[model samples]
Every structure is written in C-alpha cells, then in structure tokens.
Target chain A: MSKAVIPGMIARKTGHIINIGSTAGKEVYPKGNVYCASKYAVDALTKGMRIDLLPHGIKVTQIAPGMAETEFRSVRFGGDGPVRHRFTKVWTRCGRRTSPNWCTM
Target chain B: MRGRRAQAVEVRGLIDGLMVVRLAERGRQVKPEDQQQQRKGTHDPQMCWLACELTASGEQEVAWSTGPHAKVAFLCPMPKLILITGATSGFGEATARRFAAEGHRVIITGRRKERLEALRSELEGMHGKVEARRSFILFTSTCATMPLCKRSFPPTGMERDRCAGEQCGPRRRAGPDPGRPSRGLGAHAGHQLKACCT
Candidate 1:
C-alpha cells in the first residue's frame, strides 16, 4: 500500500506513515511461529520505510501492540471452545499484569 | 469491560504520541536558545495534561495541543490529510476517531464496505461535514505484491470523478490553494493515503 501513494508524497515532500505492529514481532511463542514471522517482517519494513522516506521529510512510525481483547483472538482461535477458553484465561492474566503499551479494541 | 478500557487508554496514547511528534516538529523549527528559554517552568504535568484536554475538546483556537500558548500559537498548524487502512475496527477505528476529533481530514480504507460506511458516517456526525471529496472510503483488500498494490491503488472511475474530478483532469494540477482553508480535495486529496501493505 505504501507503493500506491509514495509518488505523491515525493512530489509534496512531506507525509507520515504509521504502521501497526505487534508484540509477536518482538518475541516468538510456541504455537505462533508464523504469526511472529509476519509481525517481524512488519518490524523490518517500518525501519526500511523510515530510512527511505527520511530525505523526503516523511515521518514513519510503528505502533506495536500486544494482545488485547479484540476480534483477533477469535479469528486466531477459529472459535474452538476449550482451547479458546484456555488461552483467554492465560491472556487475561498477562494483560492485567503488564497492560500492553498499545492495544486493539 | 477491561478490554474496552484498554482500548481507550491505547487510543489516548496514540493521540498523545502524535501530539508529541507535532511538538517535536515545532521544536526542530525553532532555535535551541529560544526553545530552552521557552521550556522554563514548563514541567508542570497538570498544565500539559490540561492543554491536551483543551485540544481534545475541539478548541482549535487554543493554538497548539501542548506547550506555552503565546509561543505555541505561531506554530498552530493546518490539519493533515491522514489515511488509515483496516479502519473498520480495532486500533484503526480508535485512531481514526482520535484524529477526526482533532479536526484532521481522514481517509479510511477497509474491505468491509458496510463497516467502512458506518465509520465514515459516525466520524462525520461528530466532526461536522467533512467534504466527501476530501474523505474517501476505499474498498481495497490486502494486496501481497507490488504489482497488485499498484493496480489496486487507483480509484474507480466513479470515485475518481467524485474526488479527482473529470478524467483526473484540471484539479490534479491545480495544487493547493493557499488563500482558502482547504475545502476541496486539494493537492493531497486525489493521491493521498497509501501507507499499508495489509
């Protein structure tokens, strides 16, 4: 998507690009290998964008959020009852303890 | 619920983060001595928080989101045309609201047409009429490749006419009008907001 609007930003010489990342990008979990890899890619991409867009006066920011109670959990679990319940308990405790710096609804 | 409170906190943080960036930008533009002098007695957390609150309340007349009013007023800036992808829910939705509340122009994109329209309506209702030409609801999926991204980037002919104006003609070249307060799409409208891969 950055590809689409970059030309115009180049012309104007100013813009801001904010990418939403995840804590999974910073650490790997037992069953979340693929998800971690994807988020790690986001981490790398944000850095690259900042470097490339710097001379153009465009600011790039990455907001890396940890697990929050959102549709993401349901989608990731695929609505499996027992497993969903188990993970929810684990996540809820972790969430309360640390209170993620960034969160999804 | 705890989840909802977390969302609210995170959303407030996101807006405050942006406000800090704007403050940093202002800092960079001014001389170091002036900034240092201006920083005297500015450590009052209560005053800073109050300034942010005033900004959140739509008091654009306050001049800036933070800092001393007299000095910051000169740096009071124009609203940016912000483009947010996956804006139907979650962080994107919250971020959209935070920025829209501050009177910035927001162009939201998502695959869910109904949800996108709903968000657009909700924001408009809160912020007053944001000219349709300046705000767009682009229905784009997460494209994986550069070629697919380039292809998906163009607005449909109907949207193009509504936004870019006739064959992507006259308006595209007109640039921004300095005299006016940016009523139409302006230079940024037609080719704005393409900052996501997913």
Candidate 2:
C-alpha cells in the first residue's frame, strides 16, 4: 500500500496518512504483550513515515484511541457469542460503563 | 518495576510464515461462507486472510471509538472521501453508517464482504445515490470477480473515479500497476485515497 501510494503522494506533494495506533503502543500489560509490541511498532513506523514522508510534504498522524465499544474485544476473545455477551455484561456492569456493580479491586 | 515485568511473545516468525503460505495460495479456492462470516469477527481463517492482506498492503487502519467530533473534524470540508478500515463492525461500521446517512462520498473498506454489502444495500435503500454518493465499500480481501470500473454494491467494484456524477473519464481507476496486490485496487489504493482526500 505504501509502495503504491507514496509515489502518488510524493508526486502530488500533498497528502495525509493517518495511522491508527493504540495506548498499547505506549504502555504494557500482562495479556497485552503482543498487542502492545505491535502498537509500539506502529508508533515507531509512524515516526519513521513522518520523517521520510516529510520531504514529500505529506502529513502523517497516528491516532492512539484509548478504548471504546468496538469489535476489538470480540476479535481478541474469539467468535464465541455467548461468552462475549457475558463477558461484556460483566465488563459494563463494572464501571467501564456503570459503577458499583463489581468493585473487586 | 511494574513496567519491567511485561512478557511480550515473539510470534513474528509464526505470523510471517503463515502470511507466506497465504500469499502462496492467493489465487486458490475460497469459501463464500468465509466471505460472509468475515463481518461478525467470526471465522479464524477469514480473519487471518484479511489480516494477511492488510499486513501485506502495509496500510494502517485509522479507526477510533472516541466519537464523531474528532472524526467529523478530520472529514471537514463537509463531505469526505473517507476510507475506513475494519468497517465490518463497531466504530468502523458506526462511522460508515453516520457518513452514509449524511450522504457523504465515502470509500469504506473492511475484511467482511457480506457486512459491507449489507451496509451498501441499507444505505441505498434508505438514501439512494444523493449526488455525493459514489461511495465505495471495499471488502479488504481482493475479489477477482468484482470488476474494475463500475458501481458495485455488495460485490462492490472500485473505480479510481468517485462521484460517479462526473464523466467516467476523470475518475477512471488507473491500471493494475506494478506492486499492486489486486486489480486496480487492493494495494496502494489506500494511499490513493490519502492523496485524493488531500
């Protein structure tokens, strides 16, 4: 994709590439090892692309969304619908959405 | 101390190996069911295949679950040629839905064909081609069956030209150039949008 677009973007001397990053890129957790590492790589590449593509006058921005409702949880967990539903219920019930449901911590 | 305890797995070798196998089997048999199940985040094979394509294409997704405020700001100048990744579900889908409803010229992409198709039909049915509607919904995996220059809905085809309002000449998609993964699209097409959006 970069091979194809960089030429055009460089030639045009006008374009923007916004790469989606994650908080995982900057922080680390137990089960988030791979995701964190991958996001870190994204951050690295965003920096690299910013530097390299700067001459061509292309804007490179990385958006590291903290978190929200998305299929990410589904993808991370797998396609098990019931498990996902129950898990989300538990998650939302806990303060990610509502509070006083389960303050175990 | 807390930061030092992270144990990141080194699965680059395994992932790279699998990607190679997928690349080798590019033009082989694919199950339509796999195509359909892609939207729901189901089917391991489908997800892996789409992930491989994205990884191969080297396009970073730009989705966020924050809100329409930030994105709406980005898509300013009003109607945008938005190129969303993972539009099959979640924020991607919601963004696509909002944009389509507002009648923007979008170029929505995702790993799921069925979901993409479904979105197209719903949008068309509700608000059919209201001027700024050359919206292209690209199912991430390269589809050979889909033509190069036409307004495809479910089995959507991508033309380099949008706004299907203008003469097809101005917007005609370029050739299946070198280093492009599939058709006139499936490769640098994402960057093409980046340039076009600029």
Candidate 3:
C-alpha cells in the first residue's frame, strides 16, 4: 500500500498514512497469538514507516482502538455467531464498554 | 441499550480522534523556535496534548460525542486523497465515512467486492468521487498475486517487489482468506529451498 502511493507522496512532498491498529497490538493475550502478531507487525511497520518517511515529509500514524461493536469480534471468533453474541452480551453486562474486553476473554 | 449507545459513542470518538490527527498541523504557522524545538527533539505541547488525549483521556470522547450531527468547524483547505484498506466494515468503514463526510477523496480497498461497491456508492453519494478496489497489499504472503492487481489503476513495480517477499513466512492460510492467495508455493521459496538442499 505504502509502496504504491509513496512515490506520489514524495513527489508532492506531503502525505499522511494512518494505520488502524488494535489494542491487541499493544498487549498479548492467552489465545491472541496470531491476531496479536499481525497487529504487532502493523505497530512496528507504523514506526518503521514514520522513520523512513521522515525525510519525505510523510506522516505515518497508527491508532490502536480497543474492542467496539464491529464485525471484528465476529471475524476473530471465526464467524461463530452465537459465541460472539453471548460474548458481547456478557461483555456489555459487565459494563466495560470503554475498557478493552480482551483480558476477560 | 446503554451499551449500544456507548459503542456508538466509542466509534464516533475514534472518528474524532482521527480527525484530530488529520487536523493537528492545520492552519498553524511554523515558527523558527518551533523548528528549533523540533530539531532539539521536543514537540509542541498542544500536539503532545492532542496525541495523549487520543490514548489517555475520556475528555476527547465527551468533547466530540455531542451528537450524531456534530461537525468540526474547521475543514481541510484541500481535500486529501486517502487510501484505506479493510474498508468493508469495522473501524475502516467508519474512518472512510468520516473522511468522505468531510469531502475528501478516498480510495478504499478490501476483499468483499460487493461490500466495497456498496461503500463506494454510499460514500460517493455522501460526497464526490471514491475509488474502490479489491487489493490485499498488507500480507506479503499473498504477494505472489501482485501482478494480478489489474484494477482501475496500474500496480507499480515497487509494489510488485514489496509483494515479492513471499518467501518470508511459511504458507498456512488455505481457507477463508478474504483475498485470493496465489496458487502453489511462491517460486522464490522453491529456489531458496533448492539451493539449501543442494
């Protein structure tokens, strides 16, 4: 992605690359090996891109969001609708909407 | 439910945070002292506060979560061309919508062609032009199919080379991978294995 658009950004001498990361990238959990690894790679790549593109005046920022109501939980649960529903129910019941629900799981 | 409302607020807060990052440098004059401070590895306090507010404080969420129709007073003077991946759903979709609502040109890529088209139409309806494509440029394991990126725009050679790093990891993704993975193991892996075996 950066490889494709970066040349044009360099030519123009300005660009902003905002990577949507996850809280999984910041902390590893018991069963989040693969997902966390991928996000960690994203976090690392964001920093790496920031450094490399510093000379080119391209800004690379990564926003690591905690869990929210999205298809992300469904995808993470392998499309198991019932499990995700029950999880979300339990999650909301506990009243931690702003806090990351990864630890409880 | 309160949870649902909270989720909506959280998502909107995220969109607001992204806007903050987008507008952080907007309409601000660069002073000699600021440049010297930047050179000295110090950042402006306001920028630091904005950055910290994103990750630390709930004040940002409260500030932007006034209502669904809330709009930032200051808009970007020039609409930026933004490329967002995984825009079929989740945060990506929200971000795309936020930016498109602000009248920025966007290029959104994802695996689901139907969803991508739907979003493209919805965003185009909201603002102006939007480019949608089915490109998986993130995972290098899927890079073998880089040349097959025949969309509205041509794939660059550097992009092809970046995807050419297919030999970096063991190939395991078989089922349910959103975008198509190239058939057969990457050819580069074959050469490397052959050399080591010989």
Candidate 4:
C-alpha cells in the first residue's frame, strides 16, 4: 500500500485511502497473534499516514469490523469440520477465554 | 391488527404532510424584494455547506439503502479507483471481485504471482491485460532484491530519501479521479471528513 497506492494519492493532491482493518487491531485474543500484529501495524501505519498526508490533502481512513462470517473461518481451520463446528458452537461461550482448545486453528 | 392500522395512518399522514408543503411552496410566488437576491445569485456557498453539515447525521442511515442522495450525495462523488493488496485470498479477493463486478477499474497486488495472475484472469475474462513486473519483496530474511526497483523506475538511492507521494505526482492524478462527484457516498466532500477520501 505505501509503495504504490499512497504515492499515487500524494501526487494527485487529492485522494481517499481506506484501510480495512479488524477488531484484532485493538483487542488481542487467542489464535490472533500474527493477525493482530499485522492489524496493529495497519492501524499504526494509518495513523502515521493520516498525520503526514494532511498537508498534501490526502484522506486516510481505517475501518475495523468485528467477527465477520466469511471464508476466514474455513481457511483458518483448514476445513476441519468438527473443530469448526465446535468453535462455532462454543465461540460465544469460550471465545474471550484463551484456552488451548479455543486457541488452536 | 390495531398496530398495523395505526402504522398505515401514520405513513399516510407523513406522505400527505410532505406533499402539502411542496404544493403550498409551489403555489406561492416569490416576493418582489426577494427576486433581487435571486438575480444576484446571493446564496452563500458557506450556507450550502452549513446545510450539508446539518443533514450529514441522518445521511449515514440511508447511505447503503435506495435514497435519492445515495449517488453523489449532494457533494463530491465517492472514490472509484482502488488498489487492493493481499488479493490472493480472503477479503482482498472478495473486494477486488466486487469492484470488477461493478465494472470499475481495480488493481490487485500481492507477493504471490500465481495468485495475482489467477485473480487477474477472474477479473478480466479474455481481455484487458496490463502487466508490469516490479518486484518488491516486503519481508524477507535477506535484503538481496531490495534495489530491484532502481532501474526501470526512479533510481533506488535517491528514491528512498524522498517520500513516494512527493515523487509520484503525475502518476497519481493519472491513476484515479475518485474525488470528483462520485456515487454512493461522497468522498472528500467536507473538511472534517477528509479522512474518508478513499
């Protein structure tokens, strides 16, 4: 994003840059180590860019959504049906707690 | 049954009120005194801006739905050109696919060449292929390929010192014109909402 899109936005003297983030950027939970790190990086980068690009009149926004029902679950579990079902069934009850059972992909 | 009946009456009243106001205003001719202001085009752009600000709150609720102001939103148009990174899988792939489905130009980038190629094919079925080989290896144990961009584009040594935005003026403007009067939600419309430009 920095190397390509941002440069273009700066040159244009006007542009909107939306960085789609996740709640993982704010709160860290089990099984979200790498994801959280990346999201945090995005959040920080977004903040820095927003400040730096103000003079250039470039707009930067970060939209962070929570727990979307998408292929993310399928990809994360590698198509493990029972585990996926267990997580689906117990996610509400057990998601906040970082137990080994809930932690594994 | 009683609740449904009440709702019908309320809706009827609302619609009637709206039309009555419209009809009453249409019937009244402007005062001779007010015609001077009209001839002079004395409406303040600032007031136009103030009115926009007052209506901004309610506009959010109707942004995604079929509202009259959904397109252009009485301000500048929303952004159309987008660059989606990490497009090999997951959200990136879905977002890029959506832009293509809507007949908008999209540029999807990722480290995975095969995945990028697959996405390009999916987005462009048998037409419009523009390929440029610029390898930027983001995270690696070694910095062996760090200077690859020096040759075809800007020299690597000087480019690193300056910000990418400072260096790429014409390229950026030539890329997209999303800040114009766009559809859906207006991007770059208000000063406070400058961040929503994307």
TM-score of chain A of each: 0.73, 0.71, 0.74, 0.67
Higher-ranked by DockQ: 1 or 2 = 1
* Candidate 2 per-residue C-alpha lDDT over B1-198 given as tens digits, one digit per residue, 9 for 90 to 100: 343211211121111011111122233333334333322223354344454344334322111112212111111224544555666776666666555544456556677788888876765554442434455546565342233122221011224334343432222234334233232333343454455546
lDDT of each: 0.50, 0.47, 0.47, 0.42
Judging by TM-score against the true structure, name the best candidate: 1
Q: Give the per-residue lDDT of model 2 (tens digit) for A22-41.
A: 88998987898888999999
Docking class of 4: incorrect
Q: Choose 3 or 4, whichever is better by DockQ.
A: 4
Candidate 1 lDDT over B1-198, as tens digits, reads 322111111111122222321222111122233223333334344444444444344432222233233222211246555678888877777677656655555667777888988877766554333344245445556542233223222322112223221222223234344344322222343444333321
Q: Write the per-residue lDDT of candidate 4 for residues A1-105, one digit (tens) a residue.
A: 343334334434566777877789988989889999999998998998788777778888987765433467667776767877777667556544322211111
In terms of lDDT, the best-performing candidate is: 1
For model 4, fnat equals 0.03
Where does candidate 3 stray beyond 4 Å? A77-105, B1-69, B73-75, B128-198
Q: In candidate 1, how many Å is residue B3 off?
A: 46
Of the pair 2 and 4, which is ahead by TM-score? Answer: 2
Worst 10 residues of 1 chain A by lDDT: A96-105
- What DockQ does each listed candidate score? 0.15, 0.05, 0.08, 0.13
Candidate order by decreasing DockQ: 1, 4, 3, 2
Q: What is the C-alpha RMSD of each candidate to the true structure, in Å?
A: 13.2, 20.7, 16.2, 17.4
Ranking by TM-score: 1, 3, 2, 4
Clashes (N, CA, C under 3 Å) per candidate:
0, 2, 0, 6
